[model samples]
Target chain A: MTMTRIEVSKTYKLFINGAFPRTESGRSWPITGKAGDTFAHLCLASRKDLRDAIEAARAAQPKWQAATAYNRGQILYRMAEMMEGKRDELAQAISAVPNGPLAPARTKSAKRPASRTSSLRLSVSPSLSPAAEVSAAIDRLVYYAGWCDKYAQVLGCHNPVAGPYYNFTVPEATGVVAAVAPDQLPLLGLISLLAPALVPGNSTVVIASNTNPVPAAVLGEVFATSDLPAGVVNILTGKRDELLPHLAPHRDIDAIFAAGLSASEAQMLREGVAENLKRVQIHDVAAIAAGEQGQSLEHIRGGVEFKTIWHPALA
Target chain B: MTWRSPTVDTVMVGERAASFTKRSIKNATKRELLTLALSMLDLTTLEGKDSPEKVRGLCHKAMRPFERDEQMLGVRLPSCGAVCVYPSLVPTCVEALGTSRKVNIASVATGFPSGQYPLEIRLQDVRDAVNAGADEIDMVISRGQFLAGKFDEVAEEIRAVKRACQREDGSYAHLKVILETGELETLDNVRLASDIAIQAMDDVTPSGTGDGNIDFIKTSTGKVQPAATMAVTLVMLESIRDWYLKTGKLVGMKPAGGIRSAKQAVHYLVMVHEVMGPLHAGPGGSNPWLTPHYFRFGASTLCNDILRQLVRLKTGKYVAGYDFSEA
Candidate 1:
């Protein structure tokens, strides 16, 4: 008798409108491991994918903004819970790339002795381990989750006027947001940019790290299992350079939050901002990796618009 | 006269209809298709909360779909085929459209969406709209009666409403019979209902005499789920083709509701061109059904989407929904 065994490989697909779908363009790129063997394939999202993701984000923005602040907080907390449950899976995906930007910090320290010349030239900052990165991502989600219902109060204020009128300014969700995840610290950088935009009730279409997108793809799974509404958080796994040109000039996207973009990419985004007057916020990779600056209230403020209302005051 | 409608081949029809969507229409031809689709729209507002201002806004949109057309696109778009509304709003449409007559006024009558009302009352509804200056009457067929196999009663009611579409001046308003195909349940039923509507309208006024304004057989009332699927529309177009071939009498087609994108509109046009023929007389004789005089799309949201695509073609930039007027 002859027996055959087969390995069931995972097919990483794009998360669009709350469902997993292959790229409409029918294109895929291989993800290689440290041994230079193709371990998985990721969908190479096209302009059409960016269009669809923006459409989904626009459609979901109104309802997501309409949801009570408390409910939004609860959903964010639920996302954190889901992330906590998927901690082991996320760490494993991150650790798969031993020399990639998302590799655990200790791996680089362990490999330091073998390449003394390279180590001498390279400045190495202490980064989190895979397990620690996952934990920080979860904590970052909870941090923003707690800020959801309270950020508006802290950001909005009443203005004292000389006339018999009451003026008040309040921050509202800036509609659909497009985010570019950092190539370094893929999971935490993505969550850091994503959580702030989400805290203001803005629906997001995030382009995951091009080189190491598996961790972000796994985060999409966590998002699906959580109570977040479909289209509210669409994740596209593709090259940021290919998608940013389309994302910048998109008329429907109200704001863009990108991290670790090259000078040319950042310049292209800033130029495209002139098309629709959409706000573009670019952050340094070091700032995002610092965790302190990335998780601040000012980051949350980047994805909202201030609407000042004037009402007649009665004596 | 008694009529026997042909049964539709469901599988073949589905395959044929799906093939039309696979055609890749590009650049100049795509722009032309988008412009033609813009001309074929029936910008409609059929809500109970509809106001005179709303009807006027719809008429404005129907007349000039894109206000910046000349400046941005460098060509003025053709006005939409008509502005469809409830019977009560016909006078407002007449007032808004004025005497330019660029856009026709189409009113939904005969207890629209559900023709369950009494026949006499439904006929009066038709008369009221035509008298108030509606150029077209979109009357709903008695679906309940048609389903109960009272085909004669349904046909008679349609004939009565077509007659009611006549004004004192002896000019007849083109009648569109809505079969509400979503409730019809099968492609065979859709074909039969299309035949019944075409024959009933022709009994009052003979079609295909090059009159340009022929009667139509529409697919849905825009209130039902699964309104105007391609398979259902194809069956109705086939009914029209067979009628034209047999008696040289042409009937129009309108697939309202659920058609909201420019890409889908292009597919419908492809299906129409292949199943019916060319738009006008050239080397080959014209397929009259391809013209706005014979084809229409009853949609409110479809207008902005077509405009978005047209702008994308001209300016090379994708536009937002809010960039267009909400009406």
Candidate 2:
């Protein structure tokens, strides 16, 4: 008799309130690798988890916003440094899936494999290696980290009014933000959406990619080891369709940044946003993939609210 | 008074109290509990900055937690147990509540939050509050005496305050002696202090006025850090249970201070129902401890949180903080 070797798969959990906890609902779904092998199990979060994350974000937002912009910049830079250290690990997770950052789009004429095991060895050309995506994500975070302190100067303005008033408008964090990551370029896409939101000192509850979630789950390990405060950024891995209904209508969420939403899903989200008038920012997945989107200061500005202060210049 | 304080297992008391919070209360019972918890609040304002204006605001909030939505929610927003204030501010609250018999006026006296004054002054403090039309007088027992093992002295002082609550017309203001258990330190001392206070005031000279004997035993003055913790409250409730079993006189329990959320208020109700249910159920099989008369919350912010939950349940929408007026 021959003994078969068994591989130990990773157990991925929802990172909430600074702790890695299983979903309160006790439900999970399997994430299959490109080779059709089960890679990991991701926590299927519930509405209650979303509520808890919002509460944690609300509790931590004030202190985070109170921190000097320079300190926030330093923290973001540290996160980039952490990502650099975990470069190899992140690249491996992203490359595990065929529909990931490194892989080219699957064509209709591609040859089909006879067996599921042999399908893992499909002949596919690389568009970009997983290392490039991870490197781009780090560079993107560093870019946002530099913007953390400088955006205020760029976005804020000294208003010219008719009175003897020294009037100026400054940007402030828009409380708790909710972001949904795109499935393609899971790690880099998440960083692109999340970094801009955090640069303005806003706390966020992010939903990692539903299809390619291993890289996002791995990023949670970096978030934990980094000096980022607990609850500053929470990460959950699950079906976007299942989580959005709960996330959209949450009264405490100040804004939402989602990618690749269907028209109906966008409409449904808009209706939910109508209840609280939450700021909604949706990105085109294809544009983001083609590097045509998400490098602007508009993403940071979307996560911030403006306040104008006036002082008597005469006095 | 031969009733002696038993040695309390602090570990056991803590474990038992924690078990009460774990009991899952579902829709029907949860709604009922929330409403009852709302009614049990002693909507309080005890700061040095309290004035007629703040007391008036609190009184109005006590009457109408959600001015328009209370009726829309289809639940009669039964006024809270009382508006608790300083003796000087009681008259202002009384005037603010004005002709509405639904709410009572409770005044804290006896060097409240701290019983450091001379005995004569503390007694006069109780008398002045009663004269100010306080339906209930919350007096703090002298922890200095209680901690000194002067058990007899502590019992005598409670009796004095109880006597001071009496009116010339044979009606008495309901007396609620606060143990200030946070200062009592250990669970044993809390149990002992509760025993002494209950035993000293259980002699109910039947008043047709319903101003029963030592109407309630409160846990704190809300000024202490560890005010009215569940572990301490359990020991006190257990004392009430023992006193009732021995003499058949049901004494009320008030766990005041630090109980802010609606969820916590529900947990306290659960403890009351389970601890006092077997002995003190009313004629209709209702848990008698569910009423403001038998059980009360000495809280300031709890009512608004309860109102928020009530609105959510009825309107299916969570209300913003600004939706309700500041109390």
For all predicted structures, in order, the TM-scores are 0.94, 0.89
lDDT of 2 at B53: 88
**Candidate 2 residues A1-315, lDDT tens each?**
989989776778888888999999999878788889987778888777877787788788888889889999999999999999999989988888665443223333334445621322223332456899898889888989999999999999999999989999999999889998876778877888899999888999999876688888888889888788999999988787788887666677889997655545666777888877889987755444444354678889999999999999975
lDDT of all predictions, in order shown? 0.86, 0.82
Superposed model 2: Cα runs more than 4 Å off: A1-11, A98-128, A289-292, B1-3, B68-74, B203-214, B315-319
Alpha-carbon RMSD, candidate 1: 5.3
TM-score of chain B of 1: 0.96
lDDT tens digits by residue: candidate 1, A136-240? 899999999999999999999999999999999999999998889877778987998999999989999999976678898898899998989999999998887
- Model 2, residue B6: distance off in Å is 3.8
The 10-residue segment of model 2 chain A with minimum total lDDT is A117-126
Question: Looking at candidate 2, what is the lDDT of residue A200?
Answer: 84
Model 1: CA > 4 A from native: A1-5, A98-126, B207-213, B278-284
Candidate 1: what lDDT? 0.86
**Residue-wise lDDT of candidate 2 within B1-63, one digit each (tens)?**
454778999888899999999998887787889888988889999999997888899988888
**Per-residue lDDT over B40-127 for candidate 1, one digit per residue giving the tens place of the 0 to 100 score:** 9998888989999999999999998989999879999999999999999999988888887899999999988788888899999999
